[model samples]
Target: MTRTLRVFRWSPGEAERTREYRVEAARDTTVLDALVEVQRSQDPTLAFRYACRVGMCGSCAVVVNGRERWACRTRLGDLGAGAVRVRPLYHFPLLRDLVVDLGPHAERLRRALGAFTPRAGAEPYARIAGDSRERAAIDEAIECIGCGMCVSACTLVAPNPRFPGPAALNRALTLQLDSRDGAGAARWGVLLGEDALARCHGQGTCTEVCPMGLQPTASIIRLRWLGLSRLLRWTG
Candidate 1:
C-alpha cells in the first residue's frame, strides 16, 4: 500500500517547491484521503482544502496528474500504480499546497453581472410551467457548484484576466434565460464586453473537466448567439 505522493508545497512569501510523501493507503482510497493520511501520519504542515468529503461541496478540487478533478472523488485505484502529483487548481493565486484563492474568481462573476435580480413587481408565487423554455434554460445552466475547476481548466484566463471564466458566464446564461430575472438585457450587455464571452474560443476543456456535468462550452455558444441576435436587432 505504500505510495509516493508528490505534493506542491508553498506558502506566502516563499518559493514554491514539491515535497514527496511516502504513505500507505488502500487502493480504493481517494487522493484526498491519502492526503489527509499523509498530513496526519507523516507531515502535519501539509495544507489542502476539503469539505463534505463525499464530493458534494466541490471544495476538494485539485490538479492530479495534470488534469483537474475532485480529489475527494478521485480514487487512487483509478490512476493505475503511478506516482501521484497534486497541485492547487491552476489560474488562481496559490495559497498553499493544493489550495488556491477563489476571491478573484468570485470577483470576476460580480463584474460580469452574474447575480440574479428578480423582475420588478413580479409575483412571489409565480408559477413556471414544467415544459416551459425558461424552465429548461434555467435547469441547463444552474448546476454549477463553484468548484472553480472550470476556471482552472480554462486557459483563456491566463492571458485575459477580464474574461469571466466558465462558471461566471454560465451563471450569466442562467440569469439571462430566466424570465423572472430583471437583469436580462443588462447581463447580456456585460457578457458582450471585449473580455467577456468572445474570449472563450470554443475550447472544450471546461466541459471535459467539470465534475458536475455542466457544459460551459455549449452555454457560451448559446449566449454568444443570443448576444449577436440582439445586436443585429438593434442595428437593423
Candidate 2:
C-alpha cells in the first residue's frame, strides 16, 4: 500500500514548510522506515534522527498526527489511512527537517538536578531493598528514556519557558525518593522553586505522551505532597 507522509522541513534560514512524499508501505512498515525510504530514494535531503530502530533509544520520537510518538514504533497501518503528518517535537527549537534541538530539554533536566548524586564517601555497591517504599515509589517512573516528548506535550512549557519540564521533574522525583541519592536539600530547593513543582498544573499531558509509559503527572503530585509534608514538619 502507498501512504503519504506530510513531513515538516526547514533549514537555518529557510521558512518552515511541509513536504509530502508517497511511499510503498507494508503492514509492518514504520514511520521511521518510510522516512528512511524517503531519505534514501525520494529525497536525499530529508533529515531525522533514529539510533535504535526498535524504540529503546527514544531518539526517533516526533509529533505524529498531533501526538508525540516514536516514529520507529509507529506502524503506517495503524494511522488509519490518513496522511501521516510528521513534525518535530513541539516546545523545542527546530534544528532541521524532523529534528529539534534537545539542548533545552537537557538544560531543564540539569536545572532540576536530574543527575544522581551518590552519597558522599558512601560504600560502593550499596544495596536498596526491592520492596521498600522508595523503590516502589520510583518503580514506574525510573525507566524514563529522557525523550523530550513529555516536555513537548507539556502545556506549561510554551507559556513559561522557565518551567523545568515534566521529564526533568519526573527525574527529580526519582532522585528525591532514592535513599542513596545525596542531592537532598539542594534537589528540594530546585523542586520547590517558583518555576518547578508549583508550575505543573497536573494536566497529565506528560503522562499521556511519555513513550516509556511513565507517569510524570503522578511523580509531580508525589513531589508536591512530599514538599508540603517537609514544610509542615519544619514548622510543627
Candidate 3:
C-alpha cells in the first residue's frame, strides 16, 4: 500500500525541514517496518533509531500521528489515515530525523548519587523484609523497560527541560522503597529537585503512554510523601 509518511527531518547540518514521503508499505506492517522500507528503499539520509524491533529495545520510540509509541510495536494498518506523522521525542534534543539525543537524560540518572551509596559501610546488604513497606514500594515500578514512551508523552518534560521526567523519578521510586538501597538524603536530594518529582504536575500522561503499565504519577506522590516525612523528622 502506498502511504505518505509525514517525516520530521532535522540535524546540526540542515536547518530542520518537514517533508511528506509516499512509500509502498505492506498492510498490517508496523511503523518500524514502514520506516525501514523508507530508509533503505526511499531515502538514504533519513535517520531513526531501532534495535530489537520487537518492542523490547525501546529505541524505536517516536511521536506518531500525535501519540508517543514504539514504532516497532505500532502497526501501520492500525492507523486509519493516508499519512503517518513521525517526529522525535518531544523533550529531548533532536539529533536527526525521528532520533532524539537522550544522552543528557541518561547521564543524569547515572550521576543521581543514589542506589550506589551504602550506609556507613554497614552490613553486606540491607535486608528487605518480604512484608516491608519499602519492599512493596520497589515492586511498584520495578518492571519499567526504559522504553521512554512515557517520557515522550510527558507534558512536564516538554515544557520544563529540567524535570528529570518519569524515567528517573520511577527509578528513584524503585530505590526509595528498596530497604537495601542505602540512599538517605541522596535519594531525596535527586528525586525532590526541579528535574525530579517536584516537576510532575500529575497529568498522568506518563502512565497513559507507558507500555509496561507502570504508574509514574503514583510513584511521584509516594516520593512527595516520603520527602514530607523526611523533612518533618529532620525538623523535629
Query: Which structure among the candidates has the greatest lDDT?
Result: 2
lDDT order of candidates, top first: 2, 1, 3
- TM-score for each predicted model, relative to the true structure: 0.96, 0.97, 0.87
Clashing pairs in 1: none
Q: List the residue pairs that clash in candidate 2.
A: none
Q: Write the per-residue lDDT of candidate 3 for residues 26-127, one digit (tens) a residue.
A: 777898888888888879889999999887878888999899898988988889876888888887777778888887677656655534555666788557
TM-score computed on alpha carbons, candidate 2: 0.97
Range of the 10 consecutive residues with the lowest summed lDDT in candidate 1: 133-142
Model 3 clashing-pair count:
1
> RMSD of candidate 1 to the true fold?
1.2
lDDT of 1 by residue, 1-236 (tens): 88889999999888899999887878788999999999898899999999899989999999999999999999988987889999899999888877899999899899988887889999887767889877987786788999999999998999988889999998888888877878887787788888898788887999999998999999999999989999999999
Per TM-score, the best of the predicted structures is 2
Question: What lDDT score belongs to each candidate, Candidate 1 first?
Answer: 0.89, 0.92, 0.79
Q: Is candidate 1 or candidate 2 better by lDDT?
A: 2
